[model samples]
Target: MTSQPRPGPAVFISAGEASGDQHGAAVAREIRRELPDVRLFGIGGRELEAAGVSRIAGLDELSVMGGTEVLRRLPGFFRLQRRIEGLFVTEDVRLLLPIDYPGLNLRLARSARRQGRRVLYYIAPQVWAWREGRARKLQRDCDRVLTVLPFEGPLLERYGVRTEFVGHPLLDAPRSRAAAARDRAAPGVRMTDSRRVIGLFPGSRAQEVRFMLPVFAEAARQLARRHQDLDFLVARPPHLPKSLYAGAGFPTAGAREVTERSWAALTKSGTITLELALAGVPMVVGYRTGGLEWAIGRRLVRIPSIVLVNLVAEAPVVPEFLQDRLTAERVAAELEGLLGERAAGRREMLRAFDVVRERLGDPGCAARVASHAIELLARDQESPGRLGTPC
Candidate 1:
């Protein structure tokens, strides 16, 4: 008697924040495009929901940021870990792709690997910055570390990990200011004045908002005092209530649903900086943390550049004021440099963004990542040992 064939492999994904959700959704969509029959499920948010990923748990609850805050949510985090581990054991997913939530995703990868599932880590954890030793741990746990930055490849290779620079996801975004300008033409809300828009991106995390919004508001007030023609838009995160900003004393043009084009942002560093660069919106990056966190991080983080644009360009294409430097005066000064003067230097920086855009390779990162995850699953089928029985 002929036996029935086993079904196509299932791929599980875990993306904990809005940015991860965005990247994960894109990857899921690409996965669907490439392998229509493969079952895809796991934890994600609205973007992943739109991308056809069935959710095991919502990301909103897991969106805590910073060292102390993450410690506060340890109980909830452990509960989520157990749930993912349960899936790895019972459901036996063939591949697990943890997008960017390293703290959570790294643990999930180790758990999945123990259960003999192939693990592909996309957006390699910032071990180069803080926990450099985790590179060895990742090399041990993950099947392949797919990094977005060019420099990360060499760094991880030094640790004997299989790594790939699949190009940055930002490159795949709409990179032309003209494209953004065109997209804006069809907008519903009419701005009081479209002359020059100043974006305020406090950040997606509540702690970031707590630290940055007041400073950003003060900077905005300073900007308004100097130039009244400029309009201000705050890029609010989905998990946050509009009242949060209102409570912070930030004057919003009423809380509109935050979109990619909310403003020419005074951004917090990370993926959003790359997004703004691709969107052709000029920005000044800022970051601040608790004093203890800052002191510890200052000692540990070895990289010269913290913001993605700076790292990708291997130079300071945009201003980054971090820690104590992230003050209203510094932010306002940088903002003035970007918007106030419109000097040749700013124009040159915008031109440099074009090169940065070219380097991002393509917006097909989600699709590429999905395809790679499928390949890893297939490889796992041929040799189960390869998932963890590393060379």
Candidate 2:
């Protein structure tokens, strides 16, 4: 009898929040396209599940951010780390795809190396902004780093990590522009009906949503008093329960739709700001963490601008509020200026949006990442244990 075909290579991925889940799903979709029979399992949210990646480990367990919060969950983190390490060993996994959650994924990468697994880190960490020391560790742990930002390649190269600029995945896979155009052109749709809609993205994490939504709602309430026709839409992450927004006042939409319909967005600074920028929606960025974490982060983070849009452009395209500066009244005032009625302000923001989109590069980032993974897998088969060399 002819010998059976060898089994497809084993692989595992890990991502932390809903944003990571979305990007992980994008990468998985492409990986499936390249290697139809490849094993794709990961710890991510609903989006990854939809893209054919099974959630062997829960995303919620790793959803937390902030130093104090992370410290509180050290025991659980250690136990989870052991559980993941055991899975990698037992599965005989050949590859590890760790997306944007650098805090834990870096450790997992080291463990993967120890177990003879190759790692391709998608969406390199913000070492350019904070915790610059981690890039040196990344060089030792990961086989290659696929970065979204155009500038990150040189930065990581200096630290000795083999890196590639995959371009921003969002640029290649824009959600709102075409859909918003179609919606505007549809027979029944009317901008007047929505009436100066404002999108609010408090955040994707449960703790962050709980902290920011109430404050955001209050700002919306105040803005409503000045502009009676103003409507509000909260962009809900797929992983969170609607109960998270139970008392917080606003209609809800998927993150993509919120970008399509809103004239302005009141946002918590995060990766979603890049989405908002891509949508060409003028917005005010703000965030709050536990007081101690905020204090600690302030001391550590070197960047003057926390908003991704601002950092990418190296210009203050939008305002940022933090700590004592982030207040309902202050946010309400800033958002009121970005309202659809403020033609001058909205026009200026759109000009800034064009600059961001150009820097982001075009779509097809997912496919590039897939190509990298496929090449890495082929090499692992070629050399067996010599898998960690620069890809």
Candidate 3:
């Protein structure tokens, strides 16, 4: 008897922002490592490309943030979705991996499901925050919701999605300490010093850069007045123009590098805050959205906190300044307090970080997702997208 021929290895991944790029790259990297012959293709960034994924669409093509940004980029989103749906049919896509960027992924999931394809949504959408109705739609559209956050499983499962809390992808990321020691030259300037470092991550989206970088720059300027020994490192995400951070006037580095070196930081409220937390860097999280968007979100969001570190720990270890509260003076003051708040204060915060570490589960998240992908490849379910258990 002859052995059956192996199925073609093709997985479609979509990651529309810097954070997703970083994450999707890791999963792609792991999938390649585990199954050497597997082929990965997607819409992602430089990181994903480096991880061996062939990009049909660049991150810049789909990267948009804020309600206003999404509205303006609607045509581009539709075009990309249609093109991806076509690829699913043409390439015989075995599995669909949509890493965050829900607005587009949900539609893509719906289309892929119509094609009788399976979708594993990494970093599940914030239906818990707003649009609770979509949770059920996600269940209907996806085979498995591979969430990184601990709270998502219970919430999404309650709504009927087959969910798995695969810990956070950041847990499997390369150590900040290992690479932070290198005084590498990046988009802006090079860092070479013994002085302590403070990271200023204003966020990776263009809208976030526009709304937050000036405030961060001014705060950095003020903080420099008092702490002359401190060094500032800003993370410049891929696809952004070099001029984007030109006014910030600080040495720029990759986020992972800066997170390792920074003793304390004033960062935009997002996934970077949680990455910093995992690295044991105490932070003051800040964010600003369009006035109308902020007002509407404030009413709709169910959670009391926006900072992921605080949400994951179920404690206020990281301070947050949002919208009207994200003023330069206040941010500078918070950073000052965080840096000089005494060694014990930093130790106490780091101790709380231990809780965050525990909550995120262990590393090897991508490896597990890779295993799930392999299983999906073998099993052809004519029913909905549901696969087996998360392991």
Taking every candidate in turn, the Cα RMSD to the unseen true structure, in Å, is 4.0, 2.9, 5.2
* Candidate order by decreasing lDDT: 2, 3, 1
Provide the lDDT at 266 for model 2: 93
Candidate 2: C-alpha lDDT = 0.83
Clashing pairs in 3: 143-385
lDDT of 3: 0.81
Candidate with the greatest TM-score versus the true structure = 2
Per-residue lDDT tens digits for candidate 1, residues 1-391, read 9999876568898988887887888888888887778778888788888888878888678778778888889998899899878777666688888987888888888888788788889999888888888898888888888888777889889999999889887666553544355235533444444566677888887788888888888898898889877767777766777777885454454212322444456878878877777766677888998998888888898888788888878888888888888899888877787663346655666677788888777566766787788788778878876666642
TM-score of 2: 0.93
Report lDDT (CA) for all predictions: 0.77, 0.83, 0.81
Q: Give the least accurate 10-residue stretch of model 3, judged by summed lDDT.
A: 181-190
**Candidate 2 lDDT tens digits, 1-391:** 9999977777787988777788889888888887888887788888888899867766777788777788889898888888888888777788999997887899999899887788999999899889999998789989999989877899999999999888898876556654456334433344545466889999888888877888899999998888888899998876678989988778898888888887788999978898888877789987988888888888899888989988888788899888678899999988877664435776687778888889988788888988998888999989985765545
| lDDT per residue as tens, model 3, 213-271 | 99998999898898888888888786788798998889788877888888788898878
Q: Is candidate 1 or candidate 2 better by TM-score?
A: 2
How many Å off is the CA of 155 in candidate 3?
0.8
Q: Which 10-residue window of candidate 1 scores lowest in summed lDDT?
A: 253-262
